[model samples]
Target: MAARFSLTFDSVDAPVLGAFWKTALGYVDELPPAPSATRAEGLAQFDLPEDDLPEHGVWLCDPDGVGPHLSILNVPEPKTAKNRLHIDVRVPGHGSPDERWARIRAESDRLVRAGASIVDEVDGQHVVMADPEGNEFCVAATSA
Candidate 1:
């Protein structure tokens, strides 16, 4: 069996970045740990100093429980270059190429409204975009 793991992102503002991805991927904030009523409470229990914890970091999970968990944590430095590994948001459909491209374009537009910026379009197959903090990802149309 394959092991499950999370994808972590370093951000300047974790909650803001987490919100953007949650909207982009249709994910939900992961529930706080047991014995805590809220994420803040859970973090408080750790008793870590402010310096030890990333400001307002958030954890998200796939609503269908299929995709990997996401951890967005704040860091001091800014993004300097292209991502070595990135996400591909696939919007698959059954139709002509134009119809399929429409689906992909619609999703790209929605993501743009959710604080992502378009970087490029590749041969009408995919759109490259960057999150608010400049993390790169793709929106692609695939055969269903």
Candidate 2:
């Protein structure tokens, strides 16, 4: 049997992180409406405990709907330090380092406006930025 896996982040602001990932990965948020009275009444026949779910949570699937979902959880505490594991994004094509840097900078600016912090810039070749929750990710220049 294949193993099942999902990435979960203990986030102080789960909704924010969820939104970021959704934008970055082009994943859709899954939102189901409240159970209908008939459905709830039927479930109650089984004496199942009431499902008290959070009003705000995020669930995303890949474009193919194959495997692995990313779940961002809302916790009481924020991320305090650098992540031991981080994600690196490449620009998707080949070019001179300078050209790549310029592109990276432009993209970084967009992210910055979206609540990301520009932690550092390395000669436009790469940038280190933190999400709203302070999880760091790197955007690097690349050749097409």
Location of the lowest summed lDDT over 10 successive residues in candidate 2: 36-45
Residue 74 error for model 2, in Å?
A: 0.9
Q: Which pairs clash in model 2?
A: 93-143, 93-144, 94-143, 94-144, 95-143, 101-124
| Candidate 1 ranges beyond 4 A from true positions | 45-47, 52-55
Compared with the true structure, what per-residue lDDT tens digits does model 1 show for residues 1-144?
A: 998889999988998999999999999989988988987778887778778563558899999999999999887898999999999998967698888889999999999999999999998889999999999999997646
Best by lDDT: 1
**TM-score of every candidate:** 0.90, 0.71
Please, what is the whole-model Cα lDDT of each candidate in the order they appear? 0.90, 0.69
Give lDDT: candidate 2, residue 68: 63
* Model 2 alpha-carbon miss at residue 20, Å: 2.0
